[model samples]
Target: MGTESSVKAQAETQIAAVTSLSTPQEGQKNRSSGNFSVENLPAGTYALKFVVEGANSGTHFNVMKDVSGGTDPTIWSHVYSGNTTDVQTDRSFYIANPSGTNSNFTVKVYALH
Candidate 1:
């Protein structure tokens, strides 16, 4: 029984750690034009949120497709524009593993007025 309890406790601790680590720090920004990776990502669906700084008013914001590892990333389910500027916009994608292997990916956000 003690062994079982220990295993359960360890599992709970691991779950907590993963939940805390999976979430990117709020207000984090990536300004470079290269492949950015999310390490130890839980295998499931996730939304990639971007906060566009310096976006001009009246321009449409597009979450461009991913262009890394020769795989094309799809656009978000919704489009952002105009008054939705300078905020965290989210787009969903799926991951199948949590290994260190980087699912190398890139995305470009553009203005389309």
Candidate 2:
């Protein structure tokens, strides 16, 4: 494969590792919030990205540790008004999943340091 193709292949794999569908399991209920663990990751710096299936038309989404008055910390909070594709990185922010429940969108982690 060409260099571009090879790089794309690797990226696809890494993306798979970090992507999580919000759809609930067999009999579970759809949650008002979702969580994605970017764990085992060095406690350094990261860029967390979210892609809401076919959303972005003035939709509401948040990525944090608590949605209901929990004292957990938050890193990415916004009311997006555009598609969160690569070109529009303002949709991207820095925040780990904080290891438990309390996420609201598809999150991808990129380590930068």
Candidate 3:
């Protein structure tokens, strides 16, 4: 019984350590004013929540991932494209303005564990 108790305690301690290590960092970015870019992200999953404001029904904007930073736009991949609506998606490094003279939006980024 002593041996079993010791093993269980050790297991619990290891689990606690791992839990502490794997805790997600609280890094949130709110881009409520205008277009923005989120760079230097570590290798992990992420969540992007955005709201398209003051755009027409079909005003199309794209959320892209700039793997090569801002130097190259040819390599940008559109991770999300939405009109005037509030939607949540994953993975965004940069945001493009909607196609119109008067169209803009806001985005909120959160790290997912």
Tell me, by lDDT, which candidate is best: 2
Off by over 4 Å in 3: 1-46, 64-70, 74-93, 107-113
Candidate 1 residue lDDT tens string, 1-113? 56876652211001101111111224523111222333342333133233323333222223333444555443433333212222222232222111221222222232212
lDDT of 3 by residue, 1-113 (tens): 56876652211000000001111123512111222444343334333233334444444334433343444132222222231222233233344433432534333443232
Clash pairs of candidate 3? none
lDDT of 2 by residue, 1-113 (tens): 36776642212212212233333334523223334444343343333334443333444444444334545444455524232322112222233322223333444444332
Rank candidates by TM-score, best first.
2, 3, 1
Sorting all predicted structures by lDDT, with the top scorer first, yields 2, 3, 1
Score each candidate by Cα lDDT. 0.27, 0.35, 0.31
The clash tally of candidate 1 reads: 0
lDDT of 2 at 62: 41
Give the better candidate number (2 or 3) by lDDT. 2
State the TM-score for model 1. Answer: 0.25
- TM-score of each model, paired residue for residue: 0.25, 0.35, 0.30
